[model samples]
Target chain A: DVKVTQSSRYLVKRTGEKVFLECVQDMDHENMFWYRQDPGLGLRLIYFSYDVKMKEKGDIPEGYSVSREKKERFSLILESASTNQTSMYLCASSDRGPQETQYFGPGTRLLVL
Target chain B: QQQVKQSPQSLIVQKGGISIINCAYENTAFDYFPWYQQFPGKGPALLIAIRPDVSEKKEGRFTISFNKSAKQFSLHIMDSQPGDSATYFCAASYYGQNFVFGPGTRLSVLP
Candidate 1:
């Protein structure tokens, strides 16, 4: 079975602190994504990587950055954590195809104090 | 702006009843539509999906009804049970730039 594992399930950070959320996939999918889920906002993409060392900005990419140095790992970074960044972050991976389904990891709920 | 919009932030249905959730999209280039089911403390899973070429697709009790002309699609859960209670999201993608998801509907199946 394909599995996407997140490094942390819950995290708490102070304002202005830098944070890292890691995601690793075992299926060797070429495409990986980062999204933040709010109460009524659904899942909005923050960033996505099509290949190793390649990244693209999603709809909401401000205050965030991504790293895809390896094929199996993708990481989301919060430059300066704020209260507004407190949300459930989900990571996903998929094959490099237009009509492929993405497999998501158990999300990380981050709270910024 | 939200490319896809979903209605009824929450829904309540009794066991053996039908549960329906609707979604509308703004992009015409989007050709692939998928519905995801998410449980508490878990990732969203693909429940059912449909393509623009088809009007409807059914996988057992879960069905996706698509209206190509109206740019609307819906998920119908027949004979809903308690185990079916969860959040559902509708998503669309065009040439796979990225898959955009709906706000999601929280469904509660009563005993």
Candidate 2:
């Protein structure tokens, strides 16, 4: 089974604070992605990593960055957390093949105060 | 602009009835289409998927009907049950690329 685990299920941070959301996958998939889910907005991609030290910006990459120093771990960093950044963060990983069946983590509900 | 457009933001169906959600894509380049079901407090999971080559694909009571010429596809849930109530999202992606998800439809099956 492909297991994707998030570092935190819930988090609260003050404005202008630095926040990090971690995700790890056991399947050693080559692709890892970070997405923010909002009501009526669906899942918008923030960043994605195809391989170690390889990152790509998705549609909504502003105010967010990603790190993939290790094969199993992918981290999302917020330079300065703001109230608008509060959202449910989802981590997903998939193989770099034609069958891109992304397995997702439980998600981290962050509240930026 | 939304690349994928899903209709009926919310739906209500009685048990044993049919629940249908529709999605249309603006980018004809997309080839892989997948539907994801998400329960409250849980991450979305892949439910069913269909390629443009097939007109229809079915698994159990869930079915995906696709129309390549129109660039539209739909999900049909037969014998809707309370447990089937969840948010359904339709997504389209280029082969091996990032998927663009629809706004999603919240379905409620009345028991």
How high is the CA lDDT of each candidate model? 0.91, 0.91
Model 2: per-residue Cα lDDT over B5-111, one tens digit each: 99889999999999999999988777688999999978998899988889999999999999999999999999999999999999887655567888999999999
For candidate 1, give the lDDT of residue A110: 97
Off by over 4 Å in 2: none
Stretches of model 1 off by over 4 angstroms after superposition: none
lDDT of 2: 0.91
DockQ of 1: 0.57
Question: Chain B alone: TM-score in each candidate?
Answer: 0.96, 0.97
> How far off is residue A83 in model 2, in Å?
1.5
lDDT of 1 by residue, B1-111 (tens): 338989889999999999999999988878689899999878898898888989999999999999999999999999999999999999987654568888899999999
Which residue pairs collide in model 1, if any? none
Q: Tens digits of per-residue lDDT for model 2 on A57-104?
A: 998999999999999999999999999999999999888766466778
